[model samples]
Structure formats: structure tokens, C-alpha cells
Target chain A: MNWKRLAPPLAVLVLWQAGSTAGLIPGFKLPSPLQVLGGLADLALRGMPPGHRLHVHVLYSLERVLWGYGLAVLVAVPLGILMGWSRRVRDWIEPLVEILRPIPPLAWIPIAILWFGIGIRSAAFIIFLGAFFPVLLNTVSGVRSIDPLLIEAAQMLNAGRRFIFLKVLLPGSVPSILTGMRIGIGIGWMSLVAAEFTGVRQGYGLGYMIMTARDIQRPDEILAGMLVIGLIGLGIDGGLRLAERRLVRWR
Target chain B: MALHLEIEAIQKVYPSESPEGRVEVFHRIDLSVDPGQFVSIVGPSGCGKTTLLRIVAGLEARTSGRILLDGRESEERDRRIGMVFQDYALFPWRTAVRNIEIGLEIQGMPQQKRRSLAMKYVRVFGLEGFADKYPKELSGGMKQRVAIARTLVANPEVVLMDEPFGSLDSQTRNRLQDFLLRIWRERKDTILFVTHNVDEAVYLSDRIAVLSPRPAAVCGIFDVALERPRDRTGPEANRIRKEILELLHRPHTSPVTF
Candidate 1:
């Protein structure tokens, strides 16, 4: 709500509106904000390329990211906590995780396709790998950074290890977990684009629509698609930030 | 509500820089605390006062020792042991009240009882308005008070504080010292306080045990014998401080090992 923060984006929007109105950009290459909004409405009402609406594309991408990101949190967080808490766990998994972590999410797309075929499952697999390492690494770092005195205090109170994990460890790691989630979401968003371009079908993700527009030489529509993607990503990031502020009220 | 503690021939040794040697921190330490006694251990930095306190708290295992509570072995006793750290150690994610209730919650006290007991300590510490506040929102002194309250809220038989006021500013530390003295007077719980501050040791403790530096051992024990409701600025307080400082300044080489 701070006007200072809103200034830069507002200025950019005004400039974009002015440039498009003055015909400063080639019509074939760029679309105005108004044009993109109109295109968005058209896409919503009349569907994209064929019979699928914008909601269908969004829902398709959302479902894949949700399942993939959910699985990553489920598997990675506990493993990360264990590794962070014990040197033995870290010794066993750290090298393997470090090796796998450097391989780009896009690099996994071919392997994912080979393993799951070109479908929602393959896209989900790519997104899962994209999201997993960040969350795991962050959770481990978060747990590691916790004050040893806090653990001792909990122990003095006779809180068992299980209670300590639930009551102290999880809540303490939340800020880092949220950071990892934000990073994972960004990675998932980028990975989804590469995932859809690899000849996947029946899934109406925006990445697929954008690629189709590029093939058809409709660059303005492609620009519109890209704009929509950016805005949604911004919106989701903003929503997560708000949620982080509320849930981590203590911090 | 009162209990006795016996410490019999405790020792702690750490690996020395030389691979072939071990440095003894404390050797053949012996002490006893009568029911409701308040004792403080004071020494220079790296004196292992904290190490000894940790051993008594059962947070650290002594190299060799026997700790008895109420005439029974500490391992077999069901006495509640509470600790307050120098950092306050309040769970940042929990509210003041919840942090206080953590010990009782761990004891599996019913939620209603935990809340009720937590509320009592919260009010007792004059933290009524800050019950829902997080550690970040509270000042350092307030956080320390909450930490003390949290440790006492479980109705622990003995409280172990390792330099609890060492992290506070001078004025805040002084205020908390008075607050702690008032609480000990009213609650009558056994307390073992560790600090390098001779003044603090004299002000709060019924007895002050001076510890030698690193490879530490008890150098001397002096009973303050200052009357109850001891004042920081009073003449009696000054006398005790002088004695404790004298003990702390006395030099000693390696302790005689068995």
C-alpha cells in the first residue's frame, strides 16, 4: 500500500500505455497494456487457440505445480531436518543432494519425458525436481541455525524429541521454509514453460499457448501471453508474501 | 515444596591440545544444598562454573559424580529441573504465555491447566499485558523476566541459571537481580546461579563458591550470611562482595588429582 513502492511499476505502466497510444512500437512486435487486457478478456471468453479458456490453462498449470510442490515439501522438509539435526544423516545424503542440486530443472525435462512420457505427469515431475532442492536446503539451514540453548531449554522442560520437533523446530524453521517456498514457486513457474514446450498436449498451460502463438507468427498474442504469465507470477508471489507476513506474525 | 541436593566427588576432564593428555576441569568437587537454599557459583571467564552448573542440571554428564535430590539419586528422582539461559531462549514463534506453558505442556498437563498456570506466572511477573507478545516485541529485560517466569511456571524444585543476567545491560541487570531475589524469597525454590559477576554472586546467593580457571576446581566456598531481603547498596552486601572478591582473586595452580 506504500505509494513509494507503487511508483516504479505505475510509471512503467503509464509509459507502456503512452508508447502504445503514440504508435511508438511496431504492432506486430508489441501489445499495449489495454491490448493485453482485451486479449486476456477475449482469451477468457472465447478460449485460447482452440476451445480452451484462460481459466483452463491456469487451472492446468496450477494443478501441476500444486501436486509437484506439495510432494517436494512432504519429502524434502523432513529429510532436510534430519540431515541438519544429525551429522550422520548429513554425511549420507549431503553429497548426493549437492550433486543432483546443480543439474538444471530444464536439463531434467528430457529425462522426465522419457520416464513419464509427454503428459501432465512429466511436467509435474520436472516442476517437482525444480522445487525440491531449494525447500530442502533452506529447511536444513533453518534448523541448523536454531540456538542450541533453545533445544536445551526444551529438554530441561522434559519435552521429548518429538515434541521439540513439532513445537520448536517447525515453527522456528517457518521463515526459512517460506523463503524456500517463494524460491521454489519461481523455479516451478520457469520449469513449467520448458515442460510444456516439449510436445505435451491436452494440458492447457500458458506455456503451451505461448509456444503455439510463436509457431503461428502471432507475436503480439505471444507478448500478451508472456505478460499474463508475468502478472500471474507476480500475483502469486504477492499473495505468498502476504501469507508469510500473517503466518509468521511472531517474526 | 522444599528439597535437598547433594553433590559428591564430581569431576570433569576435557581433551587437552596435546593428543596424549587430558585437562581436568574440576576435580573431586563436593557440595550440598539444604532445602530451599539459594547458591551461586562465581569465577572468571572460562572457569567452568557453567560446566559445573550444567552437570548439576543433568544437561551435561560429569566425568565422575553422584547427584542426589531429596536424599535419592538424581537419576531415580522425579524432581523437576528448570533452566534459564543467558540468551533468555524464549521460542520466538510462541507467545509469552505459550512459552511459559511449554514445560507444563511437556509434562502432559491438560491444556486448561497449562493455560491457567501460565496465566498465573504471567500475572506474577507483571507481564499481563504482554501475554500474547512475541520475544522480538519485548525488550531484553522483559524477555529475561519472561524466561525466568517460564522456568518457574512448571513449579520446578530447583532452578539452574547460567549467567542469566550476563546478556542484559547494567540497569536492566540490576533490576532483574532484584526481581529474582524477590521471587526466590517468595517461592523458596532451590537455585544454582552461575556468573562471573562477583557483585551479582554476593547479592543473590546464600553461599558463593569460587571456581578456578579452565580445568576448573572449587577454590573456596564462602557463606554470605547476610540477612534476608539483602539490598544491593547496603553495608552487609558490600561486606559479602569483599569476601567473594577476595576468594575469586586467590590464585591456585592445578588441583590435586586423585
Candidate 2:
């Protein structure tokens, strides 16, 4: 009876619908739940006037997140590990990372769009900025916190520096790295929303859909877009959880 | 292939927080163990037994003096010394067999040979059914057994054990003591066991090295000379245990608690 899980939302929907019908709520400003659902169905079929389906918007948003998040991982993990493993590297890079870290992803939007220009590249660059630090910091701390005893044991067993790095350090930092990924993905999704507000030619993304619908005063379409964005985020996070279960089974 | 060790006046010092600019752990600590001998060092806490063991295994550097493993200087020695830390220090991510495979991995042994060698120790340690199990899945005693097996797989002539059974229950402690004795007898290994327990020292060691207080030195060395499967509750066991305890419990000039 996870219908209990739906109880609060259902109650809120009912209240909103009743309030709108009773003229307690401005009807156009806050659409009914049924109107939002109907809007979602219409968007699924006729494709939002530009002939782009709901699936097309989802794909565009999903691909942007994947590219940006992927690049962040590719760059950050190695950099983080190097910083953690070597004091020299950390001293060289840490101050720079700290300076850059406090700046929010949205603040970088104008410069990102300037560099990559109003397309998937600009959106992905913004998302990369969003995802980078959490992943990097967590990974660095993970490597730094590895038990010195384990490394000593490996050394006594005649393990070389490279062997210790691969066998001990890599596996030890995995759980923390996964934690970084989960957090980074959420921030990356949020950054994509802001990035998409800049718009792309011939592009249909849930964020772009919400922005245009807002300009046209279609609250129903905006709500539908929000619902889809939330559902996609939930699905991705759920998948990450499943992967986490396997990776950190030892813990 | 038992190995002999000569610990020549090993010492350690830490930078002090107090008025004394430095704290010497132990200095002029001299002891020698013949090949295949089982020696245990017992003392008050913070007497630096673990540090001495680490120095012997080349895990830590002594502030002064040196260690000789089978006539070779510590640095020149290969992976001939194995150390079993008090925490057991088994890698959580590795299976019992995989943990044993680590030493072989360092030697760049072929995969098939590594697996077979690891499986051999897995069976030797009676980890047959649990060979594939990760360290988290094993019980404390079993984890220690796996830790021992992992070290044994390295085929070191000398193994330094830092309170190998210190964390176990009394029954488990007694069981592991006998198990360790059996491994030493069968493998013909020289074991430098460090512990705080007098009974454990008297029960397992061929000789017990008693250290004085902080910045400790080998104050006395007592030979067990007891029979195999030594009685833990025997009169001689108590007598020697008491003698070692007395050596360890000498009145301290400083206000150090044991």
C-alpha cells in the first residue's frame, strides 16, 4: 500500500482543483491537476507545436547531462586522486580548486555560453562546472582517508608503489567516489535547467519547454515539464542506488 | 628456511609537546633470536613493542640503530619478513584467496600459479569453505586466520606478530595460540610475537623478552623450556609468567600507568 505514498500529493491535488473550481484560486495562474495531465498527453502526441515529442525533450536533456557529468568524472577523478596521493600536486592545485569551488554553476552561465555558444556544448559546460567540485573533493578525501595500515601491509608484502595505487587506493576510494557521483548528478541536472534557459536552435528540452510555456502563460505545460524532469531525476538516482549496492557490498 | 634476526639497540623518539623537546620511546634495546625460535616481547602499554616489531619488518624506521634479517641489513632484505598487525589489517575488498594472492601478485607470478598458491594457503588455514568469502563476511577469529594465511602465503621465513590474538575472546585466544604454534612448527618459521598478556607470552614463546618502562630496553629474557602443547595453568607456567610480570612491573621513576 504505497498508495500511502501518494496520499499527501493526492490530497494537495484535490485541494488545488477544488480551490480553482470554487474561484478561490486564479484558474489561469494555477492549472488543475487534470489540466496538467491533459497537457502532458497533448504534448506527447502533437509534439508542442514545433513537432518535437515529449521523448525528444527528455533525450535532449538526458544527453546533455550525460556528456557534462561524464566529462566532469573523466577530469575530476584523476585530478582528485593525484591531489590526494601527492602533496606536491595538492599544493599546486588545491588553492586554485578552493578559489573556484564557491562560485555557483549558474554564475558561470554567461561565460560558458560565450565560450561554447548557445548550444549543447554551452549547456554541457555549465553542467560540468556544477558536477566537478563535489566529485573532486569527495574523491580526494576518500583517497586521503585510506587506512595507512593497509598500505603498509601491501608494502611489507613487497608491493610496488604502482601496485598499491591500483589495488589498494583505487578500491578503497570507490565508495566515496560513488557518493560524489550521486550528489554531482543532481547538481548537474539543476545546472542543465539554468543552461537550457539560454535556449538552443531546433532543440526541445524539458527545461526549454518549461521556459517557453512560462513565457506563453501556459502553467499546465510548465507543470507537466516539471513532472517529467522530476521523474527522470528519480529514475537516474534510483539506478545509481542500485549500482551503489553492488559496488559497496563490502561495507 | 627459518630466519634469524638481530635487533641492534633500536630506538624511537617523538617530538614532544611538553618542556622536553623530544620523547625517546626506547633506546639501546638489544635482542637476538635464533632461526625457528618463537620469541615474545611483553611490557607495559606505550613501551614501543609495536614500534620495535615494525622496525624489524621494515614498516617503520628506528631513530637509531638497525635490524638484521638473516645476516642481511633490513633494506637489502627481500619480502622475507611478514607482519601481522594487531588490527589484523585484512583488506575488506579482497576475498580470502585474493588477499593471499597479494604477495604473489608482487612477484609477478602467473595468474594460474597465483590462484593455486593462494588456494593452498586457504586450505592450510582451514579456510576451505570460506576461501571466496570477503574479509567482512568472516568472523574475527576467521579474519585473523585469513590475515595469518595471507602472510604465510608470502612464504617469509620470519613473521612478526603484534598481539595477533589480543582482540579475541579468551577461548579464541587459546585456540589461535595453539594454531599459531602448529603453523610455526610445520612451517619452521621464526616468530617475533609482541603482546601485553603474561600468560600468552608464557604459553607460546620459546623465550619472553621483558622490557622496562617507557623508553624501554630489554630488562630480562626468560626461556620457557616447557613441553609442547604447554599447559596454560601449570605451576611452571605461572612461575615463569610471574617472573616475567615482575620484570615488566618494576617500580617506575616516572608516573607512567601500565
**Best-performing candidate as measured by lDDT:** 2
Tell me each candidate's TM-score.
Answer: 0.92, 0.96
The sequence of per-residue lDDT tens digits that candidate 2 reaches over residues A37-111 is 987986788666458788998899989999999999999998988888999999999999989999999999899
DockQ of all predictions against the true structure, Cα-based: 0.75, 0.76
| CA lDDT for candidate 1 | 0.84
Query: Which candidate has the highest DockQ of all?
Result: 2
Looking at model 2, residue B41 earns an lDDT score of 94
Candidate 1 per-residue C-alpha lDDT over A1-251 given as tens digits, one digit per residue, 9 for 90 to 100: 68899999899989998998999976667778787777777677776676878788888888888888888888888998888888999999999998999999999888888889888889888889999999999999999998888988898888888998888888888888889888988898888877888766684888888787778766666777778788888988998899999989998
Report the C-alpha lDDT of model 1 over B1-258, residue by residue, as the tens digit: 867878889998877787768888787788888889988888888878788888888888888988878878856323466788888999999999999888889889999999998999998898989999999999999999999999898888878899999989999898888899889889899888888998888888888888777666677888888876677779878877887677767666656789
Clashing pairs in 2: B25-B215
Question: What CAPRI class is candidate 2?
Answer: medium
Model 2 TM-score, all chains together: 0.96
Off by over 4 Å in 2: A1-3, B76-78, B252-258
